[model samples]
Target: MGKNQSSKIFSPELSCTARIFTLTPHFTQADHAIAGLAINHPQLVATSSARELGRHSDVSEASVIRFVQKLEYESLKDFRDALKKELVNSQTAGNSSVSTQPNTPTEALAQVVALCSQALQMLTTAIDIEELGRAADALEKSTCIHFFAAGGSIRVAQHAAFKLLRLGYPAYAQSEPFSQIAQASIVQSGSVAFGISFTGSTKSVVDALAAAKENGAIVICLTNFAGTQVTELSDIRLITPAPGGILAANSAQTRVAQFAILDALLTLITPRCEYVEK
Candidate 1:
């Protein structure tokens, strides 16, 4: 391809999920299968060979190669190298150290506080201020705003919605699965939907964001990882690094990081409120 054509075809800054989203229109059945593997099982892609990936994704080796090439990789090794780099970055960003056992409550509290502090530091480096500014602008201009979250994340969604409402924005938090989908389906232009998923694999949030995007809403995603299903559906993605492993799952550290993101977003939008400024 010519330089201009290659530039159009390749987006180095896009995550794996975003690449799949861009390629969806041109995908064959086999391509979809390969893309699914790339999006949902990136670890598998990073570790597996093209042939193995094909077998795992239920596609042929040629199909797997074609899929990688379509993503603008010169070869399977190139794709795997990129995926491995991304995985390493995510692992490093979300990595935290906390004592598995503590002799006293003081020790436990100290460990927790240390972990949370580290996670917040990671978040400071992970987030893009420019994208955050854009997200704030989107929320400020939105005629309506909706938050999609499930499980423990529902609390974060509720808090964000409440803050937005306090700022005089039309915002709602949809925690119920049915209600989330219903609201997402009807999201019109001039609306924004925020999906919060730490693991980035929450089916309810992903589905709702996808629906909202299809309905012309600007979908923003708050996720821990880049190459996730929710990120693929989002028009804007805000990532926060938190501790990984069992302790990290629904841990206080993750919640705190999420709250920090919410606070930053709210603070950025606060200036738009005449009453608040006055």
Candidate 2:
């Protein structure tokens, strides 16, 4: 395995990197160039030619072969076939993560099974063990943490605060709007602030993140959407796959994913600390 393909568990927080890690199970060193190209420019994955993908990723044709080998495919045709399957799996998994009822008994049962399966797939694909280590280290070394979430995001904020506190970290979640601003005002250097939103467009959350940044806190964003406003201000933006279908109400899935990352973070920062009492 290459230096990149270490056996680490990534937090769903490092969405982009985690996705890159998922490709490891399916790609090889030969496919790296094209795969990286496809991921960096998903637009190319659709209509672009292989030569175009090569040029865009700034890698050579030989590198594409190496990438395929890493993925463990025998030939280019095999790799492409598997790649198509992976895409289908990702899309299907996306739809299954959210449970939107179809107004029928049997349909609901099917949806429930699909939803559970999707959650497993998402959580599995989204974790990158090494990058998660980095995030954990950041959380551990920081002296304080300020959290912000609005509307749908508030749940994540609350859950993160709960975990951090239990881990004995100095963490606080902002509730009142002005309280967020006031807390941001006092964030010392070497602190971290988290903002959670699916769309990454919540104004209050954005403003609070800005304040945290101005006060010298490292801003971490938990959002699913790419190219959203909040990512512009965040030091790290963790992306979750958009929950679709009947499971839309299960924001708890997202929250649980966040907690998983927190668990990783806590583990790294305080490896010796006992998580459970005997």
Best by TM-score: 1
Lowest summed lDDT window (length 10), candidate 2: 8-17
| Residue-by-residue lDDT tens digits, candidate 1, 42-98 | 777889987799899888998987888778777888788887776665554433332
Q: What value of lDDT does candidate 1 attain over all alpha carbons?
A: 0.77
What tens-digit string does per-residue lDDT give for candidate 2 at 1-278? 33353533443233332344455324444454465454444434445444655676676756755654544455555555544555455455344323244677887566556645554557667554555555676788889888888775676677777767776778899788889888888888899988887667778888989988998988887765545578778887665554341234345555556556555565567623456322
Write down the lDDT of every candidate, Cα atoms only: 0.77, 0.62
Task: Tell me the alpha-carbon RMSD of every candidate.
Answer: 7.1, 7.3
Question: Which segments of model 2 are wrong by more than 4 Å?
Answer: 1-110, 243-253, 271-278
